[model samples]
Target: MPTVLVIDDEDMVRLVLRQFLERQSMTVVEAEDGEEGLRLLRANAVDLVICDLIMPRADGIGTIMNIRRLMPAMKIIAISGGGRSHAMELLKVAEQMGADHVLGKPFTRDQLLAVVARCLPGHPMTVRSSARSG
Candidate 1:
């Protein structure tokens, strides 16, 4: 199983994603904000990172840019939901920053799983389903 590092400020969002991803048997590490997320990335190995674009500290774009600079091999998935236009803008920024995927908020579990699959093509859980997990 490939490990996934999920970064978001919302406790509910993290709890939900933790439950959903764990159900697929993937190991998950969590960070409340991009600063902590970056710290975790630096200290531990992770196959993919799913992060929120808007946060109090070290927003997604900055984190993505920094992470790419520090660890070019790291795969990133940028997500935003509170604002659609902002999310789109951040998605573009994330792309420019070398993120592998960008997802909007209120997405289905399946959508997240699909993005994760794209990030880690050989992971077993990634290839197991095509339907919406939510």
Candidate 2:
């Protein structure tokens, strides 16, 4: 099973992602902040990282850069709900910085799964859900 590390400050977000990703047979690891996420990344073998851009202590940009430096081929999916324009800009930066995909907050499960499927094409486990979150 593919392992995914989800880094978000909100407990609800982590819980939701864990439930959904686990249903897809992925090993879900949770981290509350970018710092914690980095620590978890070091200790665990993560295939993908779904990170929030506006996080405290080592933010997404820094974390993305660090991951690129450490694990250049690692797949990353950055997310943000900062604002309409601002979030888009941040997501753009994330893509430029090496994030394989990006998603805005309130994204539906299908959207998330599509990006994930594309990220791990050869992976055996695929998310098969149509649940929406908004």
Which lDDT tens digits does candidate 1 get at residues 12-129?
8889889878988888999999899989987887988988888886788888888889889988888886755656776777787778788878878888888777778887564444
lDDT, candidate 2, at 28: 95
In model 2, which range of ten residues has the least summed lDDT?
125-134
**Candidate 1: lDDT of 100?**
77
Q: Highest lDDT: which candidate?
A: 2
* Overall lDDT per candidate, in order of appearance: 0.82, 0.84
The residue ranges of model 1 lying beyond 4 angstroms of the native Cα positions read: 83-85, 126-134
Structural similarity to truth (TM-score) of each candidate: 0.89, 0.89
With a 3 Å backbone cut-off (N, CA, C), the pairs that clash in candidate 2 are none
Query: The CA-based lDDT of model 1 is what?
Result: 0.82
